[model samples]
Target chain A: MLEKGRISNIQMEFIMVPTIIATGVLSIPSIAGRFARHDMWMTPIIGSVIGFITVFIVWKLHQLYPKMTPIQYSEKILGKVGGKLFSFVIVFFYIHNTGIVIRQYSDFITGNVLKQTPAIIFSITILFVSALAVRGGIEVIARSAVICTTIFMITSLALLLLIKDLELGYMLPLLENGWLPVLKGSFIHNAWFSEFFLLAFIFPFVHHSAKKGLKSGMKTCLYVMLILFYVHFFVLTMLGVSSVNQFYPVYSVVRAIRVFGFFENFEVIITASWVLGNFVKVSVFLYVASLGLAQLFNLSDYRLIVFPLSLLLFLFSFWDIPNVVVLVDYMTKIQPFYFVSVQTVLPLFLLLIALARKKRSDHV
Target chain B: MIGEWSIILLVQVLIWMIVLFEWKNLKKASKANKITFASILILSMILSFAKLEYLPGPITLLHYIFGPWGWFME
Candidate 1:
């Protein structure tokens, strides 16, 4: 398996930070702002708690089984047939999530940047790029993320420059709806946070202690929360209620930056930078899904199946979800529970089972 | 019509080329690996040609299990 490429703790952090922030930076404010209102800034912070929980739980699992991924070690915990079934569940989850992510990117790009262009074009292209990244192996993906991190920093700075356009008054009337709405607003953000589970697929590939892994993940989660807080604050202040009504709130906020009325429409550059993050996101999930499939069948190499998997991803990207509206509804309503359950609750259970097994073995 | 077929054919050819390129390695892979590779390729190719209408997708599943979730967007 290409000698199981290894990335350092820092490269893993670089890989994860942009991976989590990419979609949230441009997408979360609008969705979270729907319920959050003036308190939208708080969602990411509260949401980060879920991220921390996910990191810790997955870290515990990693500590228990250092040599294998959750996919590979589930057999030890669940026993043969059950393990393969669980592995398929994890694989299918990632596959389905990757498809939805590609579709989300496709919808945003086709809806905003390339109007009249088919969403499939964006989907296929991004999948192709992600496939290339996946084929290059995790080390390659991590190194590429090192470069993309620069683009991400520049984009963040550009967003910071938009503060002059923000109307701080729009953030007034905080807690008008009490903490309930803020808590509700964090539901979707928690779903994003729950994505920290993907690190389980990645954690085994890194040579680090579980404590350091959790530290890196926690730090990334905190930084992502800060960035998401800024995004929500920026959009809510710049566009106010108009931000909630817009599909791409952060993109709209970026659009509002009119430097001297000539240096305008930075959405293209922001999106170009955003693509690097999306590439890492898709590549990571694709790599893990293929890895799971390979292990499920005991294949010698995961890269052998990347192409066919992309085909599945392309097809699934347009799966039963139909339009973006329904996609948004599903994501808002069902995805939070579904993702948290599958990504966190399942692993938490698996960890318990693994611990029990360990105790039983020690006794025996 | 013809254009759709062309697109589907193009995707199939592309997938086959990749699989075949790696077939040397896959040739020695387990029976499960070969079956998995073939099954996904064929399944995706078939789905790509199928009508999108026929696929009710996750929305319907969510609607059935979770119940009329479209209101959340409002």
Candidate 2:
């Protein structure tokens, strides 16, 4: 095996939670609100249903191939040529997704915190940091996640302070436009939630039993859903349907917090938490992409490709995503279907083929 | 323009630094590993010299394939 380090189930949860929510919390509410309006809080609950199904599918795949990642097993399930082609597509999907994730992070920093600095600097710095973590392997990523996620969750709690300013009446007449808008809003989130399929890469390295890892994965999805719901609740109640107008509704709500009419400017706390969250997020994606590539070509080690892949990711962040307008447009329009198909739908197909093949072999 | 040239230069400098830092490990690495490393590095370096923002990259390609589905949100 290319990866020798093993992580416990809880550490896996810590890493995966930030991986999904790090970017989702900032960007999702506004996008969902654009469709769901006052019913935006319902979007994440609906979206997380995909998370549950993805977790079940990934677990079944893991049970069938106890010692392999999706990259390795896809080769066994398909013929050599077909498996190589499919694995390449999967690796490229992650490479592009990770690039976009970095773009999204740098966009937030430039658009919000550091307007004076060029965005590429933030992208380079974060990718460099994440590259170092990826070089250290999954255990290092897991350990840093434990610290980063704790800080992220605590700072996330600061959003609760906005409850006082929220107009409870804003959430009334829920589902007034019916479920179609809410379901439309949930579409983008399903893309994010289906990211649970990333667990396939980590499953072979997890130290605990498959059942425990499965439970933790489900709990992590619930935690992500609740966190999104909480952020949406604040954004919806405070800004109402107007939250859809702001690019970063969660950041706006965080900026509105005041404890004694004098204390405020909590945006820094949330930004710091986002930076920490993005750190773990990028590291996990980088690790998965590099590991998948190593497995694809039958390399002796994945660590060798980490820095080169990071540079490729840097190049990708600049690949036609010139500004926030283009980035958000891509996220809303193309990404939901693109990400869901590659991450969720493809895996479902692979699982079916693998299961059918297994039945044939057993009968023989 | 100086800005564009500088970006290209910066990318080269960054690539060189990575190669330099990993030279020891690269020396010990197998032929396949070395080839993979050099190929990805060269590809990114070549890509960095181009006007990437103008390039019809993966996003544009994905838009072509999945662009129709976007109407659901519209």
Candidate maximizing lDDT: 2
* TM-score (C-alpha) between model 2 and the true structure: 0.98
Question: What is candidate 2's local distance difference test score?
Answer: 0.90
Docking class of 1: medium
Tell me, per candidate, how large a share of the native contacts it keeps. Answer: 0.54, 0.81
What's the CA error at residue A148 for candidate 1, in Å? Answer: 1.3
Model 1, range A306-333, lDDT digits (tens) per residue? 9899988887887776577877777777
In terms of lDDT, the poorest run of 10 residues in model 2 chain A is A207-216
TM-score of chain A of each: 0.96, 0.98
Model 2 ranges with Cα > 4 A deviation:
B1-3
> Taking the tens digit of each residue's C-alpha lDDT, what string does model 2 give over B1-74?
11298888988998999999999999999999999999999999889878887788998898899998889987
Give the clashing residue pairs of candidate 1, or none: A320-B57
- Candidate 1: C-alpha RMSD after superposition: 2.3
Model 1 CA deviation exceeding 4 Å by range: A1-3, B1-6, B68-74
- Docking quality level of the chain pair in candidate 2: medium
What TM-score do all the candidates reach, one by one? 0.94, 0.98
- lDDT per residue for candidate 2 within A127-206, as digits (tens), equals 99999999998999999999999998898888777767879899889789999999999997998999999999998999
